[model samples]
Target: MLYGSTYPRDIFAELNRLQRELEQSFDIEPSIRGIGRGGFPALNVGSTPQSVELYAFAPGLDPAKIEVNLERGVLTIAGERTDQPGTPAQQATVHLNERFHGRFKRVVSLPDDVDPDGVSAVYQNGVLHISVRRQQAAQPRRIDVH
Candidate 1:
């Protein structure tokens, strides 16, 4: 068989096509812990007796651009990630863009025991850590008996 015309001229494009086909064949499911579509910025949530701790892993972001909100026992983290700089006149072709880009938001439902006024958030080293202190009345306390 003749070869020149049938061969793929763009190696990167061919590889990307193959990768997409393989992923489709495997029937993979998107997950929050992985770099799947719609699951930008993986999250880890945990609770302790005194407070609830939530950590969001999102790099290459401006701290000022992030918006954190807590209302009615719901916590929301939202921000935008700008795409990497490109070649002049948009001539660059991205071979692979596994990292998420653009606007993303993640919501979490908190327990009723959490105090609305006792929440704090800090973003450092590409990790946003949020702590919500539990209500004092809801915390465990030793009761005296006669």
Candidate 2:
């Protein structure tokens, strides 16, 4: 129960708890695509005066499978990561698997100054690096005071 004025009344809280219990009791099966958490590639995004750069740390993914798109002030990366090669029977117990797998799509809203046509992408050493240059007019200009 939350403290302060934010907490709901005791009766309301009890009713909410009962609702959750009833939902769990139903035990509805989940869809195949909704079975687990979808993949979300970790990224390091930064920008300079001239360009915006984004680097996604995605190992074990083929560079050819990756796709990047910039449109309407949005940058999107969508792709699928193939499964590891090996006989499933040969593998014993699994432990500590934190890496993301399956389909991944990340959309980032770009600044108004970013030039969509000037976007470039490079995949190397399991890292996807993207650079988008700023428009000529969008760059800072120095003015002379006479």
Evaluate all candidate structures by whole-model CA lDDT and list the values in order: 0.73, 0.68
Query: What is the overall TM-score of model 2 with all chains considered together?
Result: 0.64
- Candidate 2 global lDDT: 0.68
Tens digit of lDDT per residue, candidate 1, span 1-146? 23234444466544544544454457443222222332557788899989999989989899999999999999888877766576332565545435555566677889998998999999999999999999977458899998
| Model 2 misplaced regions, further than 4 Å | 1-39, 87-90, 138-146
Off by over 4 Å in 1: 1-38, 86-91, 138-146
The residue-level lDDT of candidate 2 at 3 comes to: 25
**For residues 1-146, what per-residue lDDT tens digits would candidate 2 score against the true structure?**
23244434476444533443343357422222221223256677899989999988788888888989998998888777755767342376443233444565677788999987898899888889999999977458899999
Best by lDDT: 1
- Clash tally, candidates in order: 0, 0
Least accurate 10 contiguous residues by lDDT in model 2: 28-37
